[model samples]
Structure formats: C-alpha cells, structure tokens
Target: MRSTSRTEAFPAHTPAAAQIFTTVLSHGPLTRSEIAGRTRLSAAAVTKAVRPLIEAGYLVEDADDDARQPSLGRPANPVQVDGGRALFIGVKVTGDELIAVLTDLCCRIRVARHLPLTSRDPGAVLASITALVQELLTEADGFGVAVHGLGIAVSGDVDRAAGVVRYSPFLEWSDVPLAELASLATGLPVTVDNDVRALTVAEQWFGAGVGLSDFAVVTVGAGIGCGLVVHGHVVSGAHGVAGEIGHVAIDPAGPPCHCGNRGCVEAIAADSAIVGRIREVTGIEVADTAEAVDLAHAGNPGAREVYARAGDAIGRGIATVANLLGPERVIISGEGLAAYDLFAEQIREAFAAAAFGSAARCDLQTRPLPFEEWARGAAATAIQSFIRSDTY
Candidate 1:
C-alpha cells in the first residue's frame, strides 16, 4: 500500500493554499482554471497554492492529455491530493465505547480499533483513549507514516475552535477540555467536535453529500443528531450547535428529554426512548435496545407503536430542517435504520405532511452506517484539520 504516514508539516501555510488544496480534495483532477473557479481565488493565487503542494508530493499532477486551459506553458495537468501523504487518528467516543481509525490524507481508513469504554467519566475515558492511540500508533509505524493529528468526537455542544466539549449528555460531561488533554497524552494536534458534525464532514468530503451545496444528515440511534451542510460548508454555527434537530419539539405532552424538553425528537426517537416507552407499554421487561427491537420484530403491537411514534417525531424534526433550510436532500442515517422497516413509512409520512410547499420536494434517503463508519468520520475531521480547510 502507498504510505502517507511519513508526512511532516504541510507544504503551504497560506489560508488560500489550504483552500485550493481542499477544492482539489473534493473536486479533483481539474485544470488550474477549474480550481480557481471553484475556490473563487485568482489564477495567480491558485498557481501559487498548487506549486508548493505539487512540489512537496502532497498533491500529484496526473497525465491527462486533454482539457488544457491555462495561460502558463504547462500542459494544464490535472492536480489532485495524494491520498497517501499523511496519516491521522480519529476516535469517536460514545457512552459505552471508543471507536478509532487511522486514515490517510484522503480520509481513507487504513486500520480500525474498537475498545469498550467501561466508564464515561472524563478521567477514565481519557485513559482508554490513550491506550487506543498507542495501539494505533504502533500500527502506523508499520505503514511508515507519522500521524500528525488526532480528532475526538463526542456528542452535544462542542467548541471546535476551543477544543472544548462544553456538554455531552451521554457522557454526563460539561466544560471538558478534551482537546488539550488528548493532545498532551497523544502528543499530536487535537480537534474536538460533535460526533454528528464530524460525520457530516466525512459525508461532505466522501459520501452522499459530495458535490452538494446544501444537505442535512439526520442520525438516529442512542441519540438523535443532525449535521447541516450549506453552501458546501458544514454548519457548526456560532455557538457550535446549529443543526440540533434532535431537540426540535414535536409534541407538548409526549415525552421528556434529557435537555428538559417535552416531546423533543430525541426524547421520542432515540433508542433509549423507544426502549423505555416499549417497556412501559409492553411490560415485557426488555433489557436493552436489542431486546426491544426483537419484540417489535416479533409482532408486538406496543413495541411497534413505540417505534412508530419515534419515527413520526424524527420525521417531523427532519421536516423542520427542510422547511427552514430547504436543502437539496435529507439523509437519514445511524443505527436506527436497523429498525427502518418498522417505521420507515411513518417517517416518510410525517415528513411529507409537515414539510411546507416546495420544501416537500427535497429528497429523503436512508444511508446505513455502523458505529465504525462514525469513527471514520472522526478521522475525516482530522484530515480536514490537518489540511487547514476552512470548511471543516
């Protein structure tokens, strides 16, 4: 395999250089003119940015014999990010486990490690993260690349710029300076972001939302989450809590949420919510989400009803995003799709009914991603950070 594990500091320090590189990363193999057009930078600026990148071997000029369009004497070669230029480590910290991945400059996973987090307290979780990073660093050594950065993704409000996890209900954390601690332990630059937003970064760069100017990624599982990408940029918002559709209230008297709201989408659609509601209705003493799903699949009306209501709430929440942003598409994802057959119709129905006018035309599609994929998303954030892309 081509190894990107040996890269040191990036070749260009200019913000415009990073911007041009990111444009190529997303829409690559373009002529210099195409890069300039996509990034809104002058031809001279694009040339200046691409020069050092290509020389440093971080970007490669392909042998495309056609599509020549440049005033420079060069054959208008297509430039692209060399995927194997550097390695990054991304760890997605959930309530019960730490999922980690090692990826190259293109955010392609080279290795993955899963470690169960016995405790959610910051102290204990940090230890687990350290161990996981050590394991991956050993793996990276074999690839002959130096890992440059680490990205840790958690749920709730995260100040990415400050590298602070302000709130994470699942972990019962507040004001945790996670990035600084992780950097100290792992000896790398660190980034902390909301898990869903991290996944949206991956989607923006490599998945369903590529080439899209506007899109919403709604995640359903232990918690309800949404990542909004508008104008080819992920909306982290000013307070770093822009696309929080999980808290969108659908009913005044339905269920209570950890956010202290009634009938919020998360309160209804989250896995715990469904399990709790099913146990309340079925009285079957279900132990976990798996058992609750099994009961629903076993033709239990009460269990099925819980999923239906959850679906309806999620649908309404997605509709709120559609009505507000009018994105080109709404991607329904996360582990919740495991029960999609039970409530997919309800979600579709509720979204269609709640969406207003032209907003209804927005496409709703399902993309199933396991927890490992979420870890890959975290790695993608690290790549974005290392490249200094403003969009990430």
Candidate 2:
C-alpha cells in the first residue's frame, strides 16, 4: 500500500442519501426535481441530502453552458457524482489467475493488471492479491487521491456480511476469513462477495441491468454461475447462496458433479464437463475447452454432439430460472462463450422447448465480458459498501 495521509470518510450515510447518490450515478446530471422524482423523496429531503454531498465534492452541479440543453426541456442545474473524488481497488481471484482494477468513485476502471497464481492456498492467493493491489495503489498515487476500499470477488459460497469464503470448490477453500486477512495485509477496508453477485451489482448500476428491476446474469466458464436481481434488489438468499443454477439437476444419471450430485447443470455444461465429455465420446486427447471447441468446429461428430448436449443442459437450467423468477431478461456471458457459435442454436431451441408460457417471452441476450469487467464488478461492491457503510 502507498503511504498517504488519511482521507476523510464519506459525507452521506443515511439510506436516503445512498439511494439519491446511486440514482444520480446511474442517471446523473439530473436536476433536484428529477432526483426527487426518481428516488420518491420529497424535494426538501433531496435538498438536505444534496447539500453535504456537493459541499464535500462528492456531487457537483453542471455548469450553465452544459446544463442548458433547451431542446430537452431540462433545468439549468443538475447534480452529478464527481468520479475523481476517491478511488477503489477490485480483485477477482480465479483458481489459476487474479484480475485486479483500480476504479474511480463512479466504478470506472483507471488501471488493470493480471497475475498468474501458482497456488490455490488462501495464504498464497492473499499474497498475490496484495501484490496486485499494491501496484494499483501506486497508480492511484499519480492521481493524488486515496484508495478507500478493496473488494475481492471469489467463486463459490461467499458471505459478504461476514466477509468470509464459506466454500469455494474451484479454490478448494472453506471457511476462509478473506476480508480480515486482506484488510490486514493491505491496510484498507475489504468487502468479499460471490463473483457473480458482484458482477450483478455492476450490471444493475452501469451495465445492462441499469433500468430494469428484474434480470439475471448467467455466466458460463470453468463453472456455471447465475446472479439475480429481483425487484431491484440482488438476492443473496438466506445463506449467501441464492442463484446456484449450476447445481440445479436436469439429468438424473448423466455425470457426477464435484458437488456430489449426478447430472447437475454444472456436470453437463461447465467447461470442464464439456472437455471431459468430448474426450470420452471421441476418444480424443483434447486437453482443454479451446481444443474441444476446435474439434467441434472441425466437424467432429462426437465433439459437436457433446457441445449440443452441454447447450441443452444449460438451456434447461436457464429455463428453470425463468420459470421461477420470471425475469425480464437473462444476460449470458463468460469465457465459455468462446464456443457460442457451436451451440447457440441448440441453446435457443432447448430453451424454447422447455420454458413455459409467458416465460418463453423472456429475452436471452449474449454478452462477452472480459475478466476485467468481473474485476470492475468487485469494485462496484466496494463502492456499495462505502456508500451503505456495510463494511469499513
């Protein structure tokens, strides 16, 4: 961590203040009336909350030249977040690598770095994270601002409230007090959460989920994970594991999952599952998912069949989510999208066949988000913690 003077705490802590600020963040440069209309707060309350924020440099009013867009019938002054007020660090820890980013208060990435991990041990991963965060802290120094908090997004069951990794199959970790350890190592506040949920927060604020209250983000990669936003709140479930679509069983006797279940969505559609199936069906020594995709693209019947089966399993899993939550849209993403061309039609067909009635109308949009976006999601969680005083 860089040696810098302590910065002051955020000025607004009230629920209303957080709501007002987030509203402006997603749709900023809004007049007080617009803020009040969106937040459902009284004009008086909006003024009260906006005062300290503007005075503390967290919010700024647009200048007359830019604010006066007469054609739009907008007011002369609109308040917006001053993104340069502070900085945050976000890290996404995978089994083989770590992705980190330094972001402004608005969750915009300023610097990003990647480091390969040699070990999955908690201590080893913490050291790697510390090294990456230290580099970003140095980058923040050039901007002459403080890095307020650090957010780490990890796979598996994460309890954000406790800041612990209760279980992570990819990392083979359980009961790791990650937040305390990272905070101790880097001397910054820490927030740890499930990787997909962290990503959902970013989407809700600035990505595809910005204006929608009901949507799902399903990630297909080394693992299959889903993040859900229902009625404008990210569902964490009662035990920090809400959207485990990967574990949802579709076939009773297909293959065994690491979670001790047979025929789970993960067992059928995860990258490892696809590669393993391709090797079994073709008797080919395909080493990785990339090779499996290549074989399928090369017109290998067995490899193509494996991808089709995986796509069917994934489609069914998504249908289950739609059946239960009835979301307006489902965003499909992750590295596994590399072979999307091979199975795109299969997924749509299977989903159309399985989804019930109105659920079939749900939009299924595919988005290819890089690992850096996942790290940005982690930063969004850090910003959420800072604004809500959830951790600090």
Worst 10 residues of 1 by lDDT: 1-10
lDDT of 1 by residue, 1-392 (tens): 22223236677788888878887887887778888888889888888888989898899998765656645664477888888878889999988899999888888889989999889889999999988988888898898878878888899999999898999999999999998888777777778899999999988888899888999999999999999998888999999999999998889897889999898999999999999999999988999888988999999999999999988898899999999999999988998788999899999999999999999999998999877788888888887777774212
Q: Which candidate number has the best TM-score? A: 2
State residue 373's C-alpha deviation in candidate 1, in Å: 1.6
Error of 1 at 126 (Å): 0.6
Clashes of 1: 4
Clashing pairs in 2: none
lDDT digits (tens) for residues 1-392 of candidate 2: 55432367777879999999999999997888889899899887888899999999999987665645533344448889999999999999999999999999999999999999999999999999999988998899899989989999999999999999999999999999999999988988899999999999999999999889899999998999999999988999999999999999999897999999899999999999999988889999999998999899999999999899988988999999999999999999999999999888888998999999999999999989999999999999999988888874
After superposing candidate 2 on the true structure, give the runs of residues whose Cα lies further than 4 Å from its correct spot.
1-6, 65-76
What's the CA RMSD of model 1 in angstroms? 3.0
